[model samples]
Target: MSAKVMPDAKGRQVWIAAISKKSGYSEELVASVLEKHGIRPKVTAAVPQRLMVTSLSFTGKKLGATPPSDIDFGPKPMGPGLWAVTSQRNFRGKTSILNIIRWCLTGRQYIADVMTSWFTAVTLRFTLDDREFEVRLSNASEGTGELLKHARGNEFQLASFSNHVEFEAAMSDFFMEELGLQKIENHIEKDGKGIDQPHGWVWLFTAMWVEPRPSALFGVQMPGAMSARMMQMYLGFPWVNTTNEIKAAQSRFRVKAAQSHLVSSGIRATTEGRIASLAAQRADLQAKFADVSPNTARLKLAEASQRFVNADADLRAFVAKKQVAEDDFESAKMAYAEARRSSQAAKESAAAGYVFRAIRPVCCPSCDEVITEEAAESHLRDHTCVVCKTPDRKGDDEEDTERTLLLAENEAKEQLDAQTTRVRLITSQINEARLARAKASEQCATAEAEIADMTTVEENTVRIQILDAQIAELRNLNQAETEAEDGDSKVLAAAEVITKEMYEVEQGRVLKRVSDLTKEYAVTFGIENLQSVSIDGGVRMKLIKNGQPTFFSKCTDGEKARLKVAATLAMLKVSEDEGVGRHPGLLLIDSPGDNAMVSVDYENLVSGISTLSEELKTVQIILSAVSGPVILSHVPKARRIEAVGDDYLW
Candidate 1:
């Protein structure tokens, strides 16, 4: 714990932070531990890094340059806030402008969908930490294959790509250096699967930029719980995400487990029942061997063998008959009991009905309805109970009542009579069953006695030897199963516990920290009732407001827009404070005002974002929005752009 194993984020940091917040430990303790590990980051200068899309130029010719191109979108060098690429509703290539910036920086397929027409090349320039940078990529599908380069200052010198790989490397390296991003393994759950996928430092865009569709949530996949691993790494815990040791252990364990499976399958093919039967046969064979004289070739006389075969056949027939008798007796007993129970139930029901009809009450038993004397007097002709007005099965007339009671009694008596007949028949069958069982048993005993007395001439020495061999083979199989299967089982059990413990530690470090960070940003985004943010259990970006899960898909469009902004910005703020993130303070938010919010809420959200740029000076946010009533007002004259007549972004 003293030696910082990982600098940025660790179980120790979480524990210390927890203790520091409670038991009042000084931050020096945390700083000391952090110094022992991680990149041991140097102090960031007061001046912060900033990214802006300075200019975008497109030529109308393919590959090798031809016609002079027009400047599609260019924003004034507004140092921070946002390099807003606002456009009228027809998309006006506003997204295309943002995407082109994404393409140049990350080499992603920025404009592939919209780049249907010819464009000789697209050049882009931006400044990071006051140092200007440029990327002039050839829209050519051929030649160097990729247009990528790096240059600082006012000069736009050419640094062409040696190949696509080198181009990518250069881009990654430049950003890592500029944005303070470091190389580390980040565990991402691709496609919302629970397993963690470790991607290299280059795959960091999943967090650095915001996807246009905010509902999808976390890091290129559904709120990946492990995505916090990357967020933590960028937040200055670069060393925390490097898990080379566990990976090595996992690799070794897999090989051992596979071999264990092979041995286990072999053991499964043999059954305990077969082994027990073999043991019994082996004992019989041994006894036969003991009786056989080594000098004698055959033990059975031909005449005795014929007699023995006849006795065996008679014994088998007698045993079969005994089994049949026993089965029949059990079936008859069960049937008789069931009939008797049914008859008793019918009798009880008839008795209850008679009691209910014979009695008269002043008030209804149910619902407490009153039975006035006047109502009862009128009830005699209606054949209904005066209290509740339920029609009687028999009229209230003395004769009808008597007849109904008698009918119930007769029905009960008939059921009893039918059951009594069945019971008597079953009793007689039971007696017959016992007699048959006894007779069959006596005959079986006589046949068995005859079979035992009969002698045999057949030799059993070969069979005895075979039984011994089988028993030996089974013993070997049992031994193999014990050795391989048991060992494999133990190893897997231990591995599971170890992996779970490790995951728990990771959960403590990432889950809580991400939530805390996410909540802070959510508050900054004007989310008044933001409760907490959780990225645990593989449920990524779970927003709980007022202690309940806020479903992403179900939220009003406006909420989604605001929340998406909050969650993404939360990460940037985390990286800023933690000083361990590779976020590069770059946010590519397509639009912030497109959700189901009222115009006022949208204005507040836009205003909040505009204010945020000044608060977190190091971060870069590029927004693309349809030129709406609210958008034009907040966006600076220099940053906002409206598409004319037929102008589309693409």
Candidate 2:
């Protein structure tokens, strides 16, 4: 309604719409997706009323004593306006009482360890709006308690718990429901990254307690944006919780982005390194390939190899022919010898026959008579053998047989001569084939030696092919890595921009109001030569004194005390006046006059608190300090809860 949507459904819708525009997604899809991720705005609605303590009571017992002794502290009555708890000295239980009240209210231990060990039970009674509530603890250390509400002479049980954590959570829930205080969330460091941490009543009570050491401009001194968030929560600024949630999400995104970037960069670097190595190998292979003159080498080797193969084949043929020729020569020699023998035998036979015919001798006849010559001659004329022929018919037959033997021998001699000539020719051809094969072998060897550095062109070509494949794969991987980007960072940035735009003007106005109040209250607390005070949304307070600039930490202890008080009172006053803040209207100041403070400064602080308490009737100011004339004059005797020398405040 006020131009800036309060932290609610509308706020969430606004955030979703803004993110959708940046991310190019539909609003409904964006909302569902973000919801799945647990990314939604926090709601901040201001409560107009405040909580006040009406009474406090507790019991303590001496630990480990021979006889147990119990000491009782009031059912002390406390109401609105300035109430002082004082002692002449330190550690006199003045601060203890305040700590007990805080412990009972938040269910957290703020008292000294000794008190926590000694105290057995505590009870705190407080009021919210027109309703009264009571907290009863059976064991203070364990925080075993029951929360009760009183209405029309009847008591009602609200919650009960048995341990500290449960007690704290119950109390926080009760207060959030009763007082409209929402849970606060902060980003804390875990394992070198920011994580979301939800806080309950313990964190919300930062504005309710003021420590002795003045550190920041507003609410319990904390680190980073926590203090600012505390201030904003108390001041009832619109969208404060949403802003804090967005900032925490941003912190988580930053840590994740950094980690994702490192991982992506490592992948890219490894891929690039592989690509470089493969490229170098490819270049080296290319250079060697060029030097080898592959085309010429391949041609020369092919030619020489073919020539060698052909020549070797021819040599094999020639050797086979020579073997055949040798076999034929041996056969021819044998044939020639047989032919000569045949011729000799035929001639001898012819000569013997002619001699027998010319002599005409007869060895035996039927009667061995002396007329053989005349008979043998007659038989020869008849062509018959002399020894056993009935008639003379052997002459023509013997001549014909001798003539056939002579003719066959002559033919055999001619065939042997031809075979010998053929053998000689084949032997010469074999010699020539051997010479040609040797020449071819020499040429092939020379060609092989020329391209020895390349280890045969085939292996070189394979290496080149492998190098190319690797380079291509690496390049593709590099491209994929480049394309895979972090989308969370962009979403976080968009969220940050949208949240900032939503709350800047409203937060500026709130800070200006607080700064003005701080300057005014600083003067009221008697800060010397103070011209102006400026407080930014960062909770950084700058003081302009005598035309010189300074900050909260730079001031002296006394001045810092004054500044802290001023800031606290300014916030309270602003909340009361605006009717829009969530401060509980309860201020607990512990040792505001410590650290060798100036007496006048202390008096001025007491006097100012008295006047402010009168002006803001709803605020209850509880001051713990050493009893002095200044405290005596300002705080009435009836409201002073004091401990004398060497005594506790109980």
Candidate 3:
């Protein structure tokens, strides 16, 4: 790209300066010199245009005065009156050019020299790289030169080129009459070309022009570079300074972003996984607790604990209130139970006592009278006479009745005594008869037993005598036959028959004695009347009755008494026979004596009893009588129990 220079209406000289280290000045150093001279400069590197002066600096040297070696210095107005003095003085060859351009752009003497110089009437072209670009100077006069020389003689420096330049007549006339610099539009261009297309190149510069003094130019004054540096510091870029605040902010931002991303993603995944896994775990826990729920268990345990606490509180309250004593409830219950049992037992015992009292008969002690249980109880309560303690006349008959009962009791006792006496008498007689029968039976039995073993030869003495008679007859026949050997055999036989007859007669007499003894045994002992007698292997005999016997079987209750008397009598007889007898000897007959002859055959029984007592000679008869005829006829000495009434026997 290339740039072209243009003249302003003020006839101000403008140029381009390639600022580098080789030119012994930087763009920043060039712009600083222009700023110090009160020249506002525009700066550009790739393109040229108006720019603000952000900063400036200078090298402490002067420019050379030789041709071809002179540094390029010019006015480059970036704004209405702001200009930059740019130079391309080769600092490598002549570093002093840096100070020379510094003085020309900013020195007060150089401002006067340009205003008076002959070339001041025309513009100057001060291109550093191209010769084709130039300016024409005009309208210089000797008077202007003398004024400029006088202005330079003073030590006081002008604050700006406009101080002198504004005095130059020609430049002032051109600015006012021909060029009208103040009216010229400030248009930006590129490549020394008009901005007719999007890609035109225009040489951009700034001018600070005044009459009779040199005009100043600045090339591309850049305000953006400084702003960029300020922004770098303000924004705190990490590349410039690691400790920059922006770095801390960036570090904090990155860390927060990473943490947020991790948290968000992790929370999302966890929520999803938890939803599914918790469902499965819930099912598994339910199955595991199928038999029992943990919640239920906890609830039950809590309930139980609560109940226990409640019970403990209740018990404590009860004890405090003295409603219950420690360990006393059990004892109280036991005592209650025992009391109940004892009460029941006492009731039973009382019931049994009532039963016993009902059955038991008691005689009143005061009256000697029997009373029923109820009457006895009343009598005991009243403590009155049991017979007739009442003074009421109604009891007179009761007194008579009691007297009659007393008489009856005395009569009953007398009867009992007489009956006892009679029983003893009958018992003695029966015992004598039983003993006689037993003796005769025993003797018969022995004889029968002895006869049972006898042989016919021992028993038939007649037969033995008959045999001896036969044998004797034969012998007699033989003796007779020997004496009359032939005289008559018949007569000898007759003599043997007579001898046998005499022997048979003697055996018949001995057999008759055995028949008489057997008949005597049967008649005396009554064995002939016995139906049967069973003899045991031990020789004990029992006599059986005949088909029509006189005695009764299994006696009546009344008869048992009589039979008991008979049995007692038999026992007495046996005792007497053994010489160990204790017979009372007094016979007392009671009620049976009145009807003793109901069977006439019973007379034989009575006689037999009397005969036995008489034969023993130790027995006495005492008979009690209610009727005189009965006992008086049987017993000569019979006693009657007397009553207190009119009846003698009563």
Q: How much is the lDDT of residue 122 in candidate 1?
A: 61
**Displacement of the residue 316 alpha carbon in candidate 2, Å:** 73
Ordering by lDDT: 2, 1, 3
lDDT of 1 by residue, 231-261 (tens): 4445443223333223323334444445555
**Predicted structure 2, TM vs. truth:** 0.64
Question: 81-165 in candidate 2: lDDT tens per residue?
Answer: 8999998888787888888888888888887775567877888999876789999999877888899999999999999999989
Q: Relative to the unseen true structure, what is the C-alpha lDDT of residue 138 in candidate 1, on a scale of 0 to 100?
A: 62
Off by over 4 Å in 3: 1-543, 548-553, 556-563, 581-589, 593-599, 620-630, 638-650
Question: Which lDDT tens digits does candidate 3 get at residues 153-266?
Answer: 342221212333433333233222211111111223345332211100111101211111111101122221221222122111112111122222233333444454566566
- Listed per candidate, the RMSD to the true structure in angstroms reads 30.7, 28.0, 96.3
Off by over 4 Å in 2: 1-15, 18-33, 42-44, 63-69, 176-195, 265-486
Query: What value does the lDDT take at residue 312 in candidate 1?
Result: 53
**Alpha-carbon shift of residue 597 in model 3 (angstroms):** 6.1
User: Pairs clashing in candidate 2?
Assistant: 382-392, 383-392, 383-393, 384-392, 384-393
As a whole number from 0 to 100, the lDDT of residue 517 in candidate 3 is: 29
RMSD of 1: 30.7
Candidate 3 has a TM-score of 0.15
